[model samples]
Target chain A: MAIYGVALLAGCMMFGLIIGDLLGQVLGIEANLGGVGIAMLLLIFVTNVIHQWGKLPDSTSSGITFWNAMYIPIVVAMAASQNVAAAFSGGLVSLLAGVLAVVLGLALVPVIAGKPEPEQDCQDEPATAVASNTAGSRRG
Target chain B: MFESLIELFDEYHLIAAFAVIGLTMYLSNWLSVRFTNGKFHGSAIAILLGLLLAYIGGVVTGGENGLADLTLFSGLGLMGGGMLRDLAIIATAYGVRFSEIRKAGVHGVVALFAGVIVSFLAGGIIAVGFGYTDPVDITTVGAGTVTYIVGPVTGSTLGASSEIIALSIAAGLVKSILVMIVTPMTSRIIGLDNPRSAMIFGGLIGTTSGVAAGLAATDARLVPYGAMTATFYTGLGILLAPTALFLMVRAIA
Candidate 1:
């Protein structure tokens, strides 16, 4: 678990750096700044997903915590070096694109097909409820 | 080494990058929670925001130095994350009870992966048609596309961070298109009614498509479509992941 956490954190950071550089060139932005942001976001998201999905054990939570803590500093460090004006301008474009995807995705998808059923609610509720109720009666 | 690191940051202008991306991911995640009813939808939002933040940061910082290096690294990172996420989910599902696994199951995983591959292939074809030949690699471009598109869209529509929000909405629009086209076919093949499957399927497809679009759009004008393609891929991935898995299992058995 510790290894996986480390791998995830380091991997995300490196990925951020590389992708940041590439995107910076492609879109005429800054590499380090992009790298840091990508790294932090990826690390947070990946770790959060593992936790949410119940894959990582409780003992490993600390590792994820450590990684999350590190993200702020790294990002801050990266940000300290950037051209604020350009960053904001490119950011504005990125921000606009990101917003459009989410809103349209949420609104349109549901309208067309409605939301997918929650997986948890679909199974085992009645049986578990019945079992608990019977146990309560016996205790009473 | 210290000097080099400091110089690198200074050259790149790291502070603005961090602020912009940090806020981008945060806002995107917040909007996702506000709008979506699904479990872990917030996490998805976070992931997208992170990617967007990274992409924008790279673009802003690279400036005259160019993004060649950052792009390569980001692509690799995205591929690694996608693979790790896939493996983790699959392994966890297998370890649990069969009944529990059935809820989302191996089929779902396979479908999602397959959808990603399919989307990538489709995107590559589109790229080829448009005269781009960067080798249709799914790892580097997949997640970035999703983040770039979805983060902006979700953030904007909710009146949060406009750039991130706009990206999120674009991603969603792209995903929706993919889902509308692919979900029914995948559903018929896998035999599941759950919309979650469709969502996963859509995501996979959208991610793949985003990469393809990015590669194809050598010019800046076409770059925006990268987010749209990813959104479409994701929507298809989420929707069809489960059904695709089921079909694969039956065929193998």
Candidate 2:
């Protein structure tokens, strides 16, 4: 049944929340661990395991998709609560460091990729841009 | 009638906040598609609008919790709590197909480790420069450089102070917002049109929200590939920050 996805999500969420609470209790902190990350990891592992067993029907996948779409917009609301003001008011050094890390990451992208400035708009040159890694290149 | 309506507002504030947000999103999207000519994504615009609204709410109410501190918008605190934020991340990751992810190859693995370490190092160095000589504080904020969630988690586990933890979260959130807003603008300069590049890009920038939204704006097809590596990146950060990174900080501090 398509409802299987929701069932899987519910199960994962339950376990994740339990684990998060347990971790918080164990550490004596007022915060839970990454229950959602744990839940997502569980879903990924379970679905992959089901696929390996030849039991992952298409309907359940569709069900997961449905929830994903309906849920993503909630991200904006989450960003609203982020502590941007605190980051700024914390210290000039902290703010400088945050900006510096982002800049360093951005600057490292081209160096790590071994690509040049990509000046001419690579949208028209997609084939030439990524020729090194053909689809068959295996990690294993 | 007005006094009674105020009571009703207090009762359904959460639902009302959701409606107001929805309306705001539509306007942001319209502005993005029209004025920016698709240069700025609707999500990015919505985020900017959200920040502006939060700042105004803080100023008007003279209270913490931003808009949520107001009686009519109290539901936002619950709506924007950790549970939903984490769920949104998980749901997005659940939508990925494994086949596409496998194609990232050895480059993807390298990127993951590199992203976590580089981000952490950058953060740690900055913390020390700010006169945070304590290893615990440095490591907590350093972990936050890897991702916002990892920062506080590391802090709580390591028993860092709340002030340092808040700084860590702020650092992490700053990274996330930057990743979200900047990825689109710099995509081409960094060769971000392919999955391999996307995977590498994902590894280099470990903030999941930033990578997801940035990749979505740059190219929707690349979101899953970038997000997959990013998910792994966060897990690695969580595992390393409190232990390995802390030890490194301890030695240096």
Best by DockQ: 2
Candidate 1 C-alpha error for residue A17, in Å:
18
Give the DockQ (2 decimals) of all models.
0.07, 0.29
- Docking class for candidate 2: acceptable
TM-score of each candidate?
0.30, 0.75
Candidate 2 residue spans exceeding 4 A from truth = A1-5, A12-63, A111-140, B1-6, B59-65, B93-95, B153-162
lDDT tens per residue, model 2, A69-124: 64434555655555545555556555665777788887777777675223333333
TM-score on 0 to 1 scale for chain A of candidate 2: 0.57
Q: How many collisions between residues are there in candidate 1?
A: 128
DockQ of 2: 0.29
